[model samples]
Target: MIGCRHRLRMDAAHGRELRDVVEDSGVRQRREAAAAHRASVRDTLIAAAPDAWVVIDPELRAGARAEATVRACEAGAQWIWGALLPQEPDTGRRGGSEILMRDTDRGGYIPIIVVNHKVTDPRRPGPADFHPLTSELSRWNPQPDKSRKLRQQPRDQQRLAHLYRMLQRHGLASPSLLGGVIGLQADRILVHDIAGVLDDYDRRYADRIAVVRGQSPTTPAKVPECRQCPWWTRGAEGASCEQWLTERHHVSLVAPGSRAEVLRGHGVTTIEELAAWTGEAPQDWQHGPFDEAVVTARAWLAGAPLVRRFETVRVQRADVEVDVDLESYQEHGAYLWGTLLDGRYRPFLTWDPLPTTDEGRSFGEFWTWLMSVRAAARAAGKTFAAYCYSRTAEDKWLYESAERFAGMPGVPTVEQVREFVDGPEWVDMFQAVTEQFICPNGKGLKKVAPVAGFSWRDPEAGGEASMSWYRLAVGYDGPPDLGQRTRLLEYNEDDVRATLALREWMSPRQPTAHSAVEQVPSLADFALDPRATPARTPAPVTASGGGTLST
Candidate 1:
């Protein structure tokens, strides 16, 4: 409630959030140069369009762009195309990205027809984030929606539906640069945000725009839209993933001077330490025969927070940070798994299906409660909060009974705990919680929870515990009556309880401010002169699947 007005005012800007304003202005200037470069490339492409081809500028308010472009695409004219030529690289980066989307709803992909620019390493040619330009090939094709059906329904129609609904409820526009890239699709998914596709229901309604909900059948082999993302190939190998480790080491583990000395000892006095260590190396090295300094280095990094911990050494401003994690169903659809801080663990909420009545519960049922808690937190002005959600699938029963229970409200409001369900903004708030705040080493709850004094290593609080320990206090055998369901509710409640407990437990001890080089041995070199480091090249890291561990 307190920051609501500020958030509202800021949200008014649509694509241009506060982070767009940089202190050095150099990044912005570079972005401007890149934009100019793109414009030149684009002009050469546009001039090449055939005489009869039709062009449409689908630039609406920020988030609304996708729907508008979708509308243009549905026109079915032989040459339907659009362009998002902003004047800055980062400026309207969101807007440009939104406009570049194709009908991803039905596993359809917009193809990139041209690339006038040269990309760096072909191994990692694309930016870290996917960049889809299939929608931008507008100049080559005829106007979309040539048929009478095109006139009756347009891609933007779904967007308009969402826009009107959002306007009615919040009087604010979608924060997306191109209206919810997957509008109306928000309701289906548990983690509803622009990063993911719309739910199945809304995708069905999106006639012109094809849905890309499940795993793409045609895995482009190379990364998509992310290739152009700033995070893509920009940092050292594992730099993005190791950001949390680096920051944690800087703020929590090694003292600045000692850290510098250690890195220098490795001949990695620069940011080029990409090959000098792996995030897990410290732990790995400790087992081997290493000198005390090296051992200390390993020890320090092993204990760092899961998220990025260091502040921008050069910039002085309000520091923003967010700790996040996700939870989902695992086995028997009763238990769920959570991913945070680069670690995956089990959350104990589960329900046993019964023949008489209760069979399978939907994610929405649990999510409703989570949303209410978040609403309560927002209403209370809590900061640096962490959530643990299980990231697992549901039972077959859950999928079969979907229609009747599809939109059923789960979490109860002040009026009725199960009456008022939260809207997408509530979900968006969770999504924005990170973007508004910095994430460590690209880590969130899974990684950070462990480092911030949480120990799944032990059972009493954070150690290994049984899945049954999380089950309803009562035995699972039952008629699936309300009494049994109540126990299940308690099981779910314990998760929130533990999450809050961890947040409270970790709160006071959080690094109050950035550790000065003098304080942290690991951050000494970075603190000494952050600017001295050259661009880092990272060693290729092969991602491993979830490790088998019980908690």
Candidate 2:
């Protein structure tokens, strides 16, 4: 009891023991960390080693076997060894090794490396030495005391050797030749005249070449030229026109026989000729046939400026006012309709349903609203305009309901209306539309109005809750009798508002204050001509297994 009254204290002996425990624990932790780090380093080193080649017991004359031999040579392998089995049963108990030599097309005797137990020596054999010559082999061999062989590499690496061999056998053995092959592989150009291309590059880039003597374009000395010419075309005064031929440009010159024959056949000999030939211009010369390509190439070489056609002009942001159109979607099974600016429904002017249709009435309404809204906004003296997001909300909801209504059977009789109103289907549909299109994940008209800087307060009803006109009118579907007339008008009005809003948003974001609209034509229309020539399609191919798909 007397000893317990005082706090316990460790003596020097006890203190030494406690310190020893802590030191030992720390030492254990450090050892584990060091071991882990060493393991990681060892794994990385092993993984970085190149794969080993596995030769067959008996070598084949052609295919992958031949390809691997060539690749090993190109990859800087110094020797080729073949594996052989010991004719004497006591030589190793497992197998033996040997080197192979074969005839090459270049008049030299090339060695083929194989790893097997049996071999018929190409040369008079004497010693049990000699193996494949390779940097990896040198590094791993020379120490006969080592028992294991190098790890075998994957078959894909061997196949890669085959691909390179195929390319080398073909016309692509040099860099210029290689670039042409690459260009063709990338679909950028044709690989014609590979040898000429290589020779051309060799002659041009072989020495120090001066391009221009001075800065002024007035003198031939001022404008420099390239040392190497890929096209091998030359001009007078020690200048080459090859670069001009290759560089892309818009204007094109054609020998009337070459150019006129192609265009006149297609009925586009001149601009007025083109106009009379086809009311609408061609899609684009980029998408044209080889004749157009030749013309374009010639034009660039001759330094002709591109001709501008008014029909190709784009509408600029500053020169003209913008308008937006928005219309609500009204679906009715096979047929769908809308009433522009009103929340009513119409029967005949509606869109078709899916499976038989591309897009819903909603998309069509959006397009119509865009066309009209753009025109109207211009009239209202607004260059950029937008329709509020509320219109999208309304249209989306209506589409969902109309889809549900269409899927139901028979006609909408008196009892059917009551049932439609009270059934689980109606309740679920209503809830889904509310949750998905109306709430937090989505926007109600009231919320987006403020985001777009519209400060107008909405009207509310009842003590239960307050709501805006946009919210209440949303998805009302209108009276069935009116054929969606009111719905269309309401929808379109919203579209116009939203389009106006978008334009306002875009105006401030422009990089410069420059008016883009100044360059556009007021109202240019080009009609499609029936007399235009059609392009020919390539013939389809069918194989024994199946016909291949084409774009």
Candidate 3:
């Protein structure tokens, strides 16, 4: 029987099938059986040596918890088994540990041990969403008496101090342990000794602790969350509230940072205001004090193209180029690595977990085929390049797969994989876009790929939707949907094609400094005009590359 955390993670990856099981009587019986088995084992261990450890179930009542705590304190047990206790309500903060262990009588303190599913390595920090402790640390005040002094210290020092204090408040005098089930065994680490891990986090963040504390106001950042905010609406009914006081407002297209703050400071809070503003432009442009933000905002308001040449790079053309995109379920590994070779769509898929036909096997096949194609190109005295929109996901999966399949037949050497990734043959189109343009819509491939005249076959095709499809395709939730695999493949193929389109649009073959900006069309243009000629429809391209070009 799976734990709630693991079950939830599985449900998230594979849709909401586990949610149904959670309410089922059969599943409840299984869970009860599992719990009983665990309880029996725990009881036997405790009975053998009561002074070694004490157990406190979180499901116990308040009175029972108090009784258990008192009993543990009296037992002279070295370890107290219970979830972290919440702070006093008056403390005005949040954070707790997973376990509490008695310290050796240096100062009669209790040390904390946080149990998480994730493996936290001080050397490599995981994604921002995975680090809940960081968020907790930002809100906690370790030393309320020296709050001013703490705030004055560098943000890094302040963060460390807050973390240190949070642990101390929980009765920990020594370094606390971050324990988790990594792979099959239990892994643990001392928080204070994780070298350079917190430093990396500090460098990545801009001291937003004060903003979180409500001591300072923060300018809106161009993060994924901003798109979902209630204030993000425009022209929709019931959009404006008392705070905004207007329905004509538009969100700024500028990337979050100094320029966005400058715009906000100048009373240009909305796209409508930005389009109308005639004040002095901010001196934030890389080339000059050009009103790029205003221009982009106006373009978005008018539903016009937003493109301008601020910088350019010469991309070497390859004889055989393949635009690649990977789709993976984090809990189950990568299932598909799709490619658009020339105009043809090809996919390397892994649907089974059996050793004979698993993701690792499929990955091995894909690697071999890719390397052979590269060799063929080299033999013909031409170059081969693989274009991927972003390196973060693709590179991560590539290395992970290589490690997972190391020493296996048909798999490439780890060194070979690293060399390919680091080589010039692998082009990161996202990096290319960042070096060339400052898009108000931000640097996401989904945002800019459309600007390059590319469209997905399915209107609903996206990262989240694809994950759901993959779950159904793998039969993780229930009976497999046979059609879901095709949908997943189509989505992956569309992604690669989008990457290809972007690469072509930004290639040196295009005219230099050519802007795609056009005058904003009037609202009447959107309405049917009898005088307008019917738009010509292009022929569809087949999966095997033979077809008339659309672009």
Candidate 4:
């Protein structure tokens, strides 16, 4: 209910066909690392505690374990170390939170989940998210703390609610409806009000139950989750939603989500139908450029990957431009900052394991180098700019790095980071592509960069693979693989290079005659003068039979 419906369908109907994306992704390893971190935190928390806790043996049988837990609850054990709990009989919903503490007033328990991400920030003077609790000095005692604003983790809260439901069913819930979270910093416990999230949880839970019971629609829609879903793989006969959509050239290929549904409502069932469409758009149409969407479909039909929305390509370009790409390890820190300038790739990175204090050195070096580049460009009266595919991740790390290493040598102040990012000189090429072109497929850097004739050296060059490589390169799990370090550098270099290539290709005048306006078809190529044209029926864009793309 919370995620992809298509994946839900796959799990329900063809549970065995889902493929684990292990060939080039690090999701499994990353999950393992997270689990390890959670366990380590749990171990330390339990180790530091007094003698009032109850630790159940995980190896015990279900019935036996349930009995043990019941015994502990009956005895009013102050703490339950593990998150595991007994399954309920009626709904069969069963899961555990990391830690459970006895609610003194309520005579039951509430969970304190161990999470590997930040749950709160230093907040302003306002109503507090929680009363801070320390285990040793202030165990079970929440003290006044108005400086913490909770980071809303609805999913986690939903999990807490799920556990709450199960506990309530089993008569083990705290009447207060409170839960706690131990985030990455583990500085203090942030008590969460489960009642606040219970309504949303109930709604989601009911919907999901409907989905599981075949009472709700299981039709697939193209969502971000589709890219990572194992069921999206090929050769599931007619089961793979990805194969089904791509092979049929689903209208969602161009007009995704609600727009695709809207098109279907108007008899534009396929991309071909949308492409051949010559009538007025729906009276209630509000989606971006209905005509531009038709052109995108036409581009897809013409086997063109991209369609030019504007006649002459326009993108920000500087006399001395630098392409930038940052590589990060989970939520720890950015380990590498790769930059390209003067046709040279410079990688300022740390070989020391992540979360190390030495991360400051690498970050400081990178910032100092980048600032020098900008300073020199301004001093010489040459325009300077930096490019990245997207600003979200880079901006996050930039701001975070500044905060994390504020007083380090060469580390810029937060204001400096803010000024640079907000400036027009820091260009996000992805934004430029979305503004200027109609990509029949998605407008991801990997997809769009290929249109600009840029390719990574390694076929496995992707964020997922980089994570696995980073682990090996930094010896996170074992002895450092030097080969992966080189591979990482090459990958980062290619990413920055890809950004530069894409920017140049979008430029109207460049050394290479590969400008998008010249290479790709403009709207004029397949566009019909709607006022002068008559209505036309859709031609078959694919083979004879195919299923509908939406519910």
Best by lDDT: 4
lDDT measured at residue 162 in model 4 versus the true structure, 0 to 100: 88
- For each candidate, what is the lDDT? 0.30, 0.29, 0.53, 0.77
Tens-digit per-residue lDDT, 1-551, candidate 2: 01100011111112333443333322343354444433443343335542433333245543444455545445544333332322222211222122222213232112222211111112233443433212222122122212222223322122222222233443223232211111101111111223433333333222211111121122111011121211124333333233332242112122222333345456454423332343333443333344333323222222221211232222123433323222322211222332222232223224332323333443344434434644575687755322223234334334443444443332233343344334322212112223222111123333322223433221321111211122233323332334233444444444344334423432333535543222111111112232432222222212113432130
How many backbone clashes does every candidate have?
Answer: 90, 72, 1, 2
Model 1 lDDT tens row, 429-459: 2232232222223333333333323334223
Q: What's the distance in Å from true for residue 327, model 1?
A: 5.7
True-vs-predicted CA distance for residue 123, candidate 4, Å: 5.5
Question: What value does the lDDT take at residue 324 in candidate 2?
Answer: 29
lDDT of 2: 0.29
- lDDT tens per residue, model 3, 311-420: 34345568899888898764347878888886999898878732233777788888888888899999999989998987889888898788787876567877888899
Candidate with best TM-score: 4
C-alpha positional error of residue 253 in candidate 2 after TM-score superposition, expressed in Å? 11
The residue-by-residue lDDT of candidate 4 on 238-259, one tens digit each, is: 7567778877878887787778
Q: For candidate 2, what is the TM-score?
A: 0.18
